[model samples]
Target: MSTLEIRDLHVSVETNDGPKPILRGVDLTVNSGETHAIMGPNGSGKSTLAYSIAGHPKYEVTSGSVTLDGEDVLAMSVDERARAGLFLAMQYPVEVPGVTVSNFLRTAKTAIDGKAPALRQWVGDVKTAMEDLRMDPEFAERNVNEGFSGGEKKRHEILQMELLKPKFAVLDETDSGLDVDALRVVSEGVNRVKGNSDIGVLLITHYTRILRYIHPDHVHVFIDGRVAEQGGPELAERLEESGYDRYLTARA
Candidate 1:
């Protein structure tokens, strides 16, 4: 089975004042078919960990190691990381003004598989994925995320994940800005992909609401720049009840 291992990861971002540390000695492992949820308050480094694993140039890995199946992930370029089967659904998906959604997906699929998918099957697959995600068929012709609502942007991210079929995916606050109906629809989209593929998931969020739908196999409570606690789904219930007050107090 595919495995992603992170050990003692320390990351920092450059600020006006200089380097600001965000992730401090973070360690976690995810295996194919497992869904791990990271719950944390704002600015607790959840997104930093996500972007670091995805090889964002903005976050510098000052220390520690990240590996996928024993291969060094830090050494690979960003595109190499994707081709190696790592996917990150950004907290803010950028608008691509000129690129249609269909072209973007086809290009990504081609690059990942090292060849283009056959035209008829690829077109059919795209159509079916859009229908399942509740997206209008016309969306494929529009520029990716351009003029789309927040919910539409999030839905498009899941659409990419559904099509790419990565070995592992890191979803950053995908539940944000989604209405209850949108949330359920998006969650089902995520579940649809997971059930059909051996895809490991690292889900980052600030609320337990999404947990009701996604059903994380493991939950990690992130406080400050490190993981404060880790447990099963019940941990999420505790957080929802008492909130991060205790953890905040301890950090204080």
Candidate 2:
């Protein structure tokens, strides 16, 4: 089974003064077929954690290790990580003004698979994934995410996920800025991908609404860059009822 293991990870940002720490010895493990939710307030290093694992050059991993399927993930470049079956759906997806979705998808597929797919089969795959996500077939002709709605962008991310079929995925606040209908559609797409694929998902979110659709196997409360509490779905319920105030206070 595919698995991701993070051990005592410490991350920092380089500044004039010195290296300012963000993640303070955070650790977590995700197994195939399990959905793990990482919940935290703003500035708790949740996004940093995702970026760090994906090998973003900005977020420096000062100390610790990240492994995927027992291979050293930190040793690989961003492209290498993706080719190795690690995917990150960013909280804010960028817009590439000139690149059409079809072109971008083809390039990504070629890079990940180490060869270009047949023209007919690639077109069919893109069409099927777009239809599954309820996206207009013509959207694939447009530039990537340029002039797209928030929901459309999120759905586009899911479309990429569907086509890529990564072994592990980190969804960073995918529910953010999505309406109820859009949320349901995005959640449904995620569910469809998870069904029988055994794709380990690490969903990072501040709100609990998305959990209603994508039930997580584990919920972790992140505070001050470390996990303060962890439990099952009930933990998410309590957070909904009481909020993160209590947990933050306790950790403080």
Candidate 3:
């Protein structure tokens, strides 16, 4: 089984003043077939942690290491880390003006699989994934996220995840800005992939609504860049009732 390990990770961002600390000694792990939910308020460095794992150049890993299936992920490039089976579905997916969804998916698939999926099979796979997400086939002809609604962008991200079939997925606030129906569609897409023994999910969110659909194996409360609390579904229920204030106060 595959594993994604985050070991006492410390991250910072370059600034005119020097470096600004973001993630402070955050540690977590997700194994194949498991779903781990990270919930916290804004500016808790949850997205920074996700970007760090995906090897985004903007976030600098000041200390600690990230590994995938025992391989040193910290030393790899963004594309390399992706090819090694790590996927990050961003909260704000960028708009590629001229890149059609089909082309983008094909390129990503080729990069991850080290081969080109046959034209007929590629088309079929994309169509199936789009249909599973309730997206129209014409979406493949449209440019990625250009003029699309927030919900559409989120659904597109899940579609990519389904097609790519990564070993571990870090979904960074995917439920944000989505309507109830859109949320259900995205959650269903995620659930469809969960049954695969080779996939593990790190679902980061600020609300418990998504968790009601995903049902995490473990839930972690991240406050001030560190994991302040850890529990099962009960923790999510508590957060739904009391919010993050109690945990933040205890951490303070």
- Top TM-score prediction, candidate number: 1
**Tens-digit lDDT string for candidate 2 (82-122):** 99999999899999999999899999989999999999988
Cα RMSD of all models vs. native, in order, equals 0.5, 1.1, 1.1
Give the alpha carbon lDDT tens digit for every residue of 1-252 in model 3.
888898999999998999999999988988999999999999998999999999888899989989888899999988999999999999899999999998999999998999999999888888888988999889899999999999999999999999999999999999999999999999999999887546999999999999879999999989989999998989999999999888777877
lDDT for each of the candidates?
A: 0.96, 0.93, 0.92
lDDT value for candidate 2?
Answer: 0.93
Q: Which 10-residue span in candidate 1 carries the lowest summed lDDT? A: 243-252
| Model 1 per-residue lDDT tens digits across residues 1-252 | 999999999999999999999999999999999999999999999999999999999999999999999999999999999999999999999999999999999999999999999999999999999999999999999999999999999999999999999999999999999999999999999999999999999999999999999999999998878999999999999999999999999877
lDDT winner, 1 or 2: 1
